[model samples]
Target: MDFWEADELAAHRATARAWAEANIEPHWAEEQHRTGCHQTMELHARLARDGILAAGWPAEYGGSDVDPAFAQAIFDECAERDLHVDGWTTTSMVLHTIAHTGTEAQKHEYIPAALRGEILIALGYSEPDSGSDAAAAKTTAVRDGDTWVINGQKMFTSTAQVCSHIFVLTRTNPDVPKHKGLSLFLVPTSAPGYDLQPIHTLGGQVTNATFFTDVRVPGSALIGEPDGGWNVMRVALIYERGVSSPSRIEKTLAEDLASWAREARRPDGTTVLDDPLVAERIGRIAVDEEVGRLLGRWTNWQAAKGGIPGVEGSMRKLFFTEAEQRHFSDALDILGAEGLLAPEAPGAPAGGAFEHGFRAAVVTTVYGGTSEILRDIIAQRHLGLPRNRPGG
Candidate 1:
């Protein structure tokens, strides 16, 4: 894999960086100041209007039809500036799957509007009893004439409070095996019987517990063939797990730590950064960041070649999340008690970003998929090992 971006991507990155500085930088601190999920419709629309939101999508779907790397360039710019695109990320995952598997009518109705940032979709996969076992969903959707009546709950439904719809996984045919009985739906959050309550995490992020009590959606809401949701979900998870864009958190943290260390002094009056141990730890972080970036680039390259990343997604996901955990631990240790300070606290290093990141990194290993589960996937799917779970 090329360590450097191609000329076209490099030029695109320059443009994206300028756009982010003008549009995102001014408001970024305010967004960060807020406790959780701070995406706003104004910013979302601006991203679309600037052609950054869907740059890699097909031309008919409000995109420029450039290589997928173009979209990744936009993401890298945002991350370098500490701009949160969680809302767009989840929406894109669902939209990508829809573009591939949805009916023509469904495509016509949702695609353009979503790209224009008129609608947002939240993931509704985890249930109270089904954390990593998404196929074991108990959320039922029963067909009644032309409508489907849904009744159940979804946990960790991030962005539900602000999203227009939820890409839900429901048990449509419980008589069949767990994975075979499922279906997917694009349920409107505005519909009656739909409700959500917030779930605050230590990371200062807000997810939700969503409830559906006889929620009725038209047949058009069905994303793919009934009992074929597992396959549809696999596609969406590929987008989620795959390193379509590299995460800059670890990189940012290391930079911040180095900056703080440069200004910090030891009791002996020498700079903390002058210490060999501190330098070695930061060096380790840089190495990890580069490896993770290359892994992401490999997966993105596959997508650019019109192939969806398979177990390679699992590999990147596992490596990146675990590396993130390790990076933060090292950061906190280097920063000492001052590192634990919250953002608003006086004299906090890098505005307490490392502190908040330390907390935030805790969930990276849990969401999307757990580290343990990802390892199992890598073993069974990538390594050709027998399934560790029973009855496999």
Candidate 2:
């Protein structure tokens, strides 16, 4: 592992930092943290207009096609600034999958719009019945004359509320096995018979439950072969779980917690940062943050070298998310009763960021994949362990 940075990446980092400083409004962070409202289309248009949205994508698809390290730098910088780039990350992951596995027509139809941030897509993988057991999806799509009619429900769709399209996985052939019968479709959210309802969580963010009542799409909507969606989705999930780095929330929380620790005063006239135990906790968190950053950078490097991010992605996600949860849990302990104060309360530390973070951290362990499921993948796929039998 080379602990070195390339000159081009360094330049991109400088450019991204400058752009963010100038364009990322000061109020945007507070607004997003308080309301969980990310600048989706506006941010996309800005990034695209500035030629920074899909930096690693090929120039043919309206991307700069720069080094993959530049992509990592872009994400790192965004995280540093507390910018929510989940939508952009999701778009890039799907677009890259299409570029790799999609038909030329599919590429031509979706890539440009995706790069421009004009077309928003939501991931329709998790189901009400299948949370960690993503392969257990029961949504069905039956082929008709020139269209596929989909009927099922997807839960925990993060941006289904605003997204124009959904990349869904459905059982194309129920007679086949669980993973084999699956296929992926790019269904329009505005299509007739589709309904989306927001599921409010303790976390500030609003995920959705999307129901499809005979939603129909043309044959062209199919990303790959019929009943081969599992394969396509597997690739996409790998990219989803692996390629993207740690959540920016983690970094923002870390920085905020560090700042709070330095000055947070107890009723006993003792500042938290001065206490040895508190200092050690802060040190530990900082160390974990560094480790997460390094692991993410390595994953990016491997991808740039044409390597698949297999266990590395799982490792990063698992470690970073757990670290994030720990960071907030520590913050709550440090704040004691005051930590319970909501963001709206007066004199709340950093506007009750820790309180909000604690709630949001709960979903991190569940989303993408639960820690339990991720451990299973690491064991079965990465460690070559035997798959666990039921109740084993």
Candidate 3:
């Protein structure tokens, strides 16, 4: 598909650039790199009030109702400026799914609230034993009178500490097969009997481990249908991977690497970027960033035309994440001994962003879906190949 932005989109891009320049705090990028915290809800609310956060949603739902290309331009601009838009993007995707499949009452109640940036939703698909094997989820939700009683634990749930609600998957019937008996529910974080514990990672981000002991919600909390959460989750997963932009991580690393290469002098007073090898490495990373952008545009085009991203989304997710890891690894190699310094050290390069990135990149390959799983989908579904065996 032709993925170039059109004239109207270019106009939108200009507007986005100006808005970002005027409003984005000067220290926001450095703060995000150092603390791993995006702007607060007050900042989010300001963006929402200015119609930036709801750029792609329909007008009736408090969005701009702009074309998908326009939305892509906005995302590109945000990435170019080194902004953290993942939390906002994920919330919008979940809101879109609700608009498409939710009951009228659900849309009336949640869509406006989400667009207003009043409610932050956390995804609850992963469990201690069911990370990639989401179908093996054992979280149970039993019907009692007019409510569902949930009892299970969810692990590696990002942003659960600050979210208002959780879009969770639970097994409604055990007699059914692994993928058959699951159901999706919108559980309020304030619900009685729900407990959350933060999981600190090597990279310093805080994900969560949540336990539900007789957590009860009304039957209205169910989304789509009972014993059908697998399908709902499949749809949500497609949106998650497809709408994701590589700009945040890629831009942050690229700009940092360039700045460091320009400033760090060799033993003979030669700068790193002046080295042919360093130039080649940066060129390759730039190419990967361009390709990832095109892949994202293609995914958006498909969605705009009423088709799901399918295998293409997996390809983009796998390629871009791996590219991010490779880009930073090359930076570390260029820095040599200086790269080993921790962020807390007195004179570390880029405040140890590369060091943190290396550890974080290891987790990226495993999260969402592993590179191995994405490769399997590409072969089986995209290439129409018979499943590979040990020696096949």
Clashing pairs in model 1, backbone N/Cα/C closer than 3 A:
none
lDDT of 2 by residue, 250-325 (tens): 3655567778877878778888878888778877887888788777777766877767787788888898889888
RMSD of each: 2.1, 2.6, 3.1
Better of 1 and 2 by TM-score: 1
User: lDDT rank, highest first?
Assistant: 1, 2, 3
Question: Best to worst by TM-score, what's the order?
Answer: 1, 2, 3
Query: How well does model 2 score by local distance difference test?
Result: 0.78
- In candidate 3, which residue ranges exceed 4 Å CA deviation? 3-10, 25-39, 65-82, 246-256, 387-392
lDDT of 3 at 320: 83
- List the candidate 2 regions with Cα displacement exceeding 4 Å: 4-14, 65-77, 246-255, 390-392
Candidate with maximal lDDT = 1
Q: What lDDT is reached at residue 188 by model 3?
A: 91
Q: Point out the worst 10-residue segment of candidate 1 by lDDT.
A: 243-252
Top-TM-score structure, candidate number: 1
TM-score of 1: 0.94
Q: Is candidate 1 or candidate 3 better by TM-score?
A: 1
> Which pairs, if any, clash in model 3?
none
Model 2 RMSD in angstroms: 2.6
